[model samples]
Target: MVAIWLDGRMRPSTAASVLVISARQVQRLLRRYRESGAGAIRHGLRGRPSNNRIDCGVRDYALAIVRETYADFGPTLAAEKLAERHGLTVSSETLRKWMIDDGLWKNRAQRRNFHPPRLRREHCGELVQIDGSDHRWFEDRSPACTLLVFIDDATGQLMQMRFVPSESTFSYFEALEGYLKDHGRPAAFYSDKHSIFRVSKTEARTGHGMTQFGRALAELNIEILCANSSQAKGRVERANRTLQDRLVKELRLAGISDRAEANAWLPTFIEQHNAHFARVPARPKNLHRPVNEPASRLRDILCWRDERYVGNNLTVSYERKRLILEDSDLARSAVGHYVETYAFADGRVDLRWKGVSLPYRMFDKDQQRVTHAAIADNKRLSEVLAYAMEMQKAAPPKMPRTGKQRTRYEPTGLRSPGPKSLLAKRAERRVAEAAAQAVE
Candidate 1:
């Protein structure tokens, strides 16, 4: 309307009044209409391709890489791999659409149920949520293993991650050592009721009513809080889920099929992940306290400790293995006294009496079997069984006896039963004679 009125030679002031706009706006409209006609008023770049659009060649290259290398990866991870490995940068959503169109990924119709949000801690290291996630991290390239994750409750930063054969006290101790070395001693560790952190049985024989891990943390002046439910420690639980998705693919792409390789690569991954996802804490102060103990003390505290009573011969039994203390005045005095044994994760065992090292020789009384099924965790169960089968196959077969096979009641010894065997023969002869007379 303003254009027509202006074309009819209406004054700029009159057009502005009719259009409820300033005369400057009316003159600007007139200029636009005269310069490019009516259609030029629309956006100039509407019908053109986006300047940021991915090129066809790049898209085809990325798609080809995805199809060959990341066929099982989700869109987000596939996009990341395309950018990181192939140098083909594309938006995750664009990659998702491409994957959906190419039949490489599926969009699920199911909706995710909401989980009520929990407030984060006020300061970093106030509460470190820890857990172990067992998965096929290397897929079929190697055996499955457990990843120990320690995440801060406040910042959601992964404080430490270590790959282990299983979730055991030794594994947690190793991870905790790394965490303390990196971030100091946290105020408290939040975790699930795994036997490593909590005693499952009420009648358990822990003298201090604490697990080995709990004892270690207590000695370090750090508290351990066991969550009653998985939701209570949801931070680490959710992190485990994300890691199972992202970290697995990362290991696969890096060709990391073993725990050593994964552990070596974890620090870099942690830095990148935290840089991307860690949040600023409500308070800037770090809640972690510097450890006051010496490195040796820390090592002592982090090991598996148990008390054993020395027998009359200065012998002690641990894990079905016997140890003979060297005969000295002090060692002889230690006989019938209780001694502490510290078993380290690296297979080092130390015996101490009143904080003094005791020299001893180990005698393995019980033979160790190839398979430790009872002690193996879910991650190593299959491998343990497979190894046991192999060991059985490689074992030598027993020889068949002609006529010297012993009966169940027969005794085999270095000395022969001379007098005893003759007395037993006389008794058998007398009994047979009495039976024959009775029959006649």
Candidate 2:
């Protein structure tokens, strides 16, 4: 602009408009340019220190106090403490820069790890991200619980959500069952490499090669994807953060602290949430496929399905319970072979031979006591402790039993029943809807 004005092509007022300065300032700049050339364009106080800078002595004292007493304190807290105790008032940012120069603190750029962003899926149901966030949702009104979240990657929709005691296999099973019933089978489920989703132990000899949840998805013809890092499943991880803020407030507003009540009312919240936040997909298509299998089949698939070797006397030992198969041709046939066991969420176990249910009688079905040497995995420690407490409440005072009876567990197995299976509840709801439609 100065060059333009010097060339006589622009009026002083025009220069003022272009430079966002007063016409008087433009005129002064023109005079300065003619007298001193390009150097006149720089501010008069370009290299001078600010009049607002603190005294050298004061800055030195502040740095000395910070280094001597509050070396580990953050900038904000240090500022507060300086003002309260030492009668010194320095802005947090100013002190932050000083600390950075003194090697007392790392800058934000140096402190944070960068994660590159990934594009969302093109269709709503093409990739559904799932996660379990363990938090204190009730704010002292109730014990902390885990919230299982299912969110669509493309639309950012809250496809499904439920509260459970913890992030266990059965908890995920219940949540997955609800999601399947509501939105059908998504093309794939993206999740963190949790043991429930992926086999964390590579050399373990259990569950063959896949987890129970993985096997269930295989049966449903859906893909289970494990993210290498938490940032990889950023969709559901971010959703968990948002829900920790918004859902907790909503629960407080409704005075709902119980998991059961919150679950019953979550559909309304989900609808409102989707209305406010869910977006249109890049491609206007939903990739979710309808569930072709019956509810019973889904129930069997979702439950804990493990194969056990049948003994010589047609007996199967499961969770320390001796399941003696009723004397029959099928039971005798399975005696020397492996029979599949379906452990339902409702604590019912079914022994099947090649997809055929075999009747059995429970003998010596007493709960196994948890021993001191029993290595409870970190994932299930809370549940194991809770079971131990419950067993202690009902157990009679007696000397420690010898032999295999040292660790008797409660009747409710290690992973006890969570909320009843949503399968039956959803089926009843569908039937009621059909009945109402027929009446109308």
Candidate 3:
């Protein structure tokens, strides 16, 4: 995005140069601006306003047509439909903006950044990002399915792999179980705000609680972190995209497609992939160690949702509804039905009551209601994009058509102080947009 922005306008090429971009970029930006105006310069489509956006009425009528007829169509196809039916024409980009403005566009959920997601984790294995991508990973060789991927944030190691339908606690469990069986436990697991990792309404945490996945990590003495921004976990996500492209071919070439066969073939893929792509760490191998728990006990750590509650004394009360109801003999006291405060390996708290989970909360005995000391979440980018289109605060001061004096041009928000620096202005906005995109 920044590269596109810095293209075209001329800037010095010195160390003191405000924009350290290439000359070709300047020409491109200039061509775009000339063709599309400031919109082009801002990376928007350049050219005359779409003939379809001829007037507010046409725009409205076109939108109405879209909402009623081709509502489900993607922007490009919808634009074509508008031209064919209403004889109103507009570029897909223009239609997209109109739909976005009207809140009719799809809202893809994005996992955000660190609690303070800073740079890469300070030490190898300090933060291991785990995520799953549902894709045609085997290309035409196999049916589409999800690949569970665990990547070490510090060293960029592809630590573990598994195949599943959708990314779920069970899939993650099976993968993490394998990881633990091999590499042991890391300091923490980094992930997106998936329901398993997040405190959601469906399974609210006890005033003191933890999610099931969080509980497992806590049991293994590992921390759990959900990124504040999706890009914050770019290590795993970027890897997912890369693998979807590369690994799919490798699988196809090897003539592997069946799910079980794919899974069987993954060990060979991992070894070859790691050998070619893995990097030497700035630090040595991580200090992770396996849990010394018995096999049965370790398997218990991989469970999904289980009924639990808090005791009257504020202690976690739990019962077994699964196979080993009598394994601990504690289920005798816990069953008929009871609750337990779920302790996550990452150390969060989850309180389940009457078979339903509640949101994590902090309560003041006096106030007696739930409260979150931390802010809920950040605002949506669509809100800011909408705000970007607000009309000027006051009517445009008309240039006197009657003016005999040569016109003196004044730049609006596009200029920097003390001098005309279109180059620097573009650079500033370019950087700003990049930062905003990183968070989204």
Specify the highest-lDDT model's number: 2
- Give the candidate number with the greatest TM-score: 2
Ranking by lDDT: 2, 1, 3
Per-residue C-alpha lDDT of model 1 across residues 334-422, encoded as one tens digit per residue = 88889999999887789999888999998774444563346765655666787677767777644567775565456556686456577
- Score each candidate by Cα lDDT: 0.86, 0.89, 0.68
Model 2, range 169-232, lDDT digits (tens) per residue? 8988999889988989899999888888888888987657888889889999999999988999
Could you estimate the TM-score for every candidate? 0.62, 0.66, 0.47
Predicted candidate 3 versus true structure: per-residue lDDT over 147-207, tens digit per residue: 8899887777788988875565666787888898878878988898877787666455453
RMSD of each: 18.8, 22.6, 30.5
The TM-score, computed over Cα atoms with residue i paired to residue i, of candidate 1 is 0.62
Off by over 4 Å in 2: 1-112, 377-379, 401-440
